[model samples]
Target: MDFLTITLPISGVAINPLLLVLLGVAVGVLGGFFGMGGAWMVTPALNIFGFPMPFAVGTDLCHMAGKSIISTRRHAKFGNVDVKLGLIMLSFDVVGIEIGARAVMLLERFGLAGLVIRWVYVVFLALIGSLIFYDFIKKRQMDKSGGDQSKSAITWHETLHKIKIPPMVNLPMAGVQCSLWLPATVGFMVGLLAGFLGIGGGLLMMPALVYLIGCPTYVAVGTDLFTIMLAGFYGAFTYGMKGRIELLAVVIMLAGAAPGAMIGTIATKYIRGYGIRLMFGATVVCAMVSVILKQMGQGGAASWVIMTAVTLMTAIVAIGMFKGAARELRERRLSHEPR
Candidate 1:
């Protein structure tokens, strides 16, 4: 056990390298499947495991930039990415990141970084998780009642699409026709959270793209990952300049994350629509519970809870991918039979 421990040069923390790799793998899977950088889990997990909050934020961002490149590429092959929409969001996202980074710095100056950020995570995760479940339940009721099954129970995006402000954009890829300001506004807010929470904004951005921008679930997943890549890179640079990034940890994590990301992205091809939303809701709730445990002075329990949550979610995604791939193969075989 002691033999596996390595000291991080920058952070001066001696931790098992295996933990870093495990976190990377989990992030990779969840990021690809959920279209996030998995920072919401990683930051708290890292902090729970020993890193300072600032270092956790910086290292997570650095690793996210690399992992997202892999996920984004895979999603594009499936025609899930809305390049125009992602590009539009990137500009505002960067500005929001800068503002968020500054806010983090200010909080650090007052020695309230960890406390404030953890509480924020609890609140944000609760809101997002609740909304997802509520939507899922509502949709299920509609299905039972023989109502319109194609529409989401929550129709916020419908209202947003009607804004029709000047300089509208038509995104054929995402099947969205709305004002450019819509994504810009969403991007800025997501970026702000990304910077403040070190989450790369995927947690909120994915839902926003689906619920507010009216992109299909898969398109939202891909586009959110695209924004995450840009946000992660900018966030890493900003945190690196501040001397908060742990390069050694980032490299170690990426070793596991790269492959895990591919698995998660491929899984998305099999698990569509509400399936992703339901699992994502569960993941968020698990993460929120872990954060709450940490805030309750139960660091060891928090670490176990978060790690277990990631492992379970990763297993579910991997299993879905295997089953889907097998089904496709069987279908192909049947279709090509001597008929």
Candidate 2:
């Protein structure tokens, strides 16, 4: 065990590199499938493993930027990305990230960074998780009653689209027409969270694109990954300049994340729509419970809960990909047979 431990040169903390690789692989799959950077899971996991909040955030952002680039490219090939919409959101996202980074730095100075960040994670995760589950349940009820199946239970995007503000823009890929400010506003808010939480903004941005910006589920996933890549680059740079990042950890994580990301992005082609939403909601709920446990001084339980959730989700996504691939091969073989 002692031979497995290595001290991070910058952070001066000894940790098992294998653990970092494992976290990377799990998050890479979840992030690619869910259209997030998986910072929500990694930051907490790193903190539980003994890294300070700031270092955990910085290293996570650095690792996320690289993984997101891979996921975004894969999504683009599937015609899932809306480039125009992603670029528009990027403009405002960077500014919000800067503000958030500053806020975290201030909290660190006061020795309240860890406490404040953990509490915020609990609150934010609760809201997002609840909304996703509620929407999933409502959609199931609609299916049973033979109501319109196309409409989601939460229609905030519809109302927002109807606002008719000036400078309306059309996103053909996303099949959306709305005020230009709509996505920019959403970007700023999500970016704020990214900076403060060390996330790539994908956690919030994916749902925001679907529920607040009117993008289709697949398009939202791709576009969110695009935005996450750019935001992650800026975040990594910001944290790096502040001497918060551990390059050794980032490199180790990327080793596992690369292959895991490919599996996740492909799984989306099979899972589709509400399936993604359901898994995402479950992931959030698990993360929230783990954070709550950590706050209650159950550190070992918190670690187990989060790691178990990540491993399970990764397996689910990988299984879906394999099954979908096999089915496709069978259909292709049948098509080739002389009729």
Candidate 3:
């Protein structure tokens, strides 16, 4: 495929057709499995493949909207989504995004904005991803020993839920009756980062929902997908109104991701909490590796072989997840009494 040029009133931007499809395929898998678009994968891929930074950001926002629609519709069908939480999150996301955008502009004046924003994104990704990784690891160890933690340890959600603040609101999906600040704070923080980086911030939101708000893994996947649905539409509309979006590319990506998302979302049903967390953590780790390679490439130490390595690593991770879930299902089937 050839790179297509989309001209805005200000300037024309070039987008690689092959890279867009590649991004759609990878994000579709991650999004369907965990309800996160892995826009952390999209934005960087766009930038590296030769789109101007602004266009890359804008176009990914458009693409994310379509993907989120497919994902949200699928997840919502599973009886896991919380509409109230999604609406509450929507209220502050706009405010956080605007303030976050202004902050980025201020950083840009000093020529340090891009570096600072990316470093911040990586830190958040690592911190949130590490927390999920730790929980899954702890649970795996306990399973091996036939022991379980009795909810007495300091989990981020447990700590936050313990605070006796006023105006406790209930989130059925999160299964918490804590202060409004808890949910709003988590959403606002992630929203701010998303606005600044032109990302969907599902990685940030999903973990915060699980650990910060005590949402179950499956439910958090649903809630996160629902909220991303709103953000994506708003983002794409804003960009499209400004004539900065490539609608053609977005349409093609959507055509693939829609059905892929349906299958990905269904796969979660056969998977356990630990299995989902393992895969989710593994996805972030793979995204991290992808980022590392892109960084090395920037430093002139990368090769096309690195992309192949990334693809292989990602495939192995997905297969490992699917196999783990299959084994669990098979064992459960074996343990059941015949009807």
Q: Residues 1-339, candidate 2, lDDT per residue (tens digit)?
A: 779999999999899999988888898899899998888689888887789999999999899999998999999999999999999988888888889989999999999998998899889989999998899899899889998987787889999998887899999899999999898888888878877975567778888898899888889989988988887888899999999999999999999899889989999999968999989889888988988998899988987898889889999999999999999999999999999
- For candidate 3, write residues 290-339 as lDDT tens digits: 55555555533333433454355446545655776788889899889586
Candidate 1 on 153-208: residue-level lDDT in tens?
89998998899898999999899888999999998888898779865677788888
Where does the lowest 10-residue lDDT sum fall in candidate 3? Answer: 298-307
Q: What range of 10 consecutive residues in model 1 has the weakest lDDT sum? A: 194-203
Error of 1 at 286 (Å): 1.6
How far does residue 218 in candidate 2 sit from its true spot (Å)? 1.5
Judged by lDDT against the true structure, how good is candidate 2?
Answer: 0.89
Query: RMSD per prediction, one decimal?
Result: 2.8, 2.9, 4.6
Q: Quantify all predictions' global Cα lDDT against the true fold.
A: 0.89, 0.89, 0.70
Residue pairs of candidate 1 with colliding backbone atoms:
none
Model 1 residue 82 lDDT?
Answer: 95
The residue-level lDDT of candidate 1 at 100 comes to: 92
Error of 2 at 270 (Å): 0.3
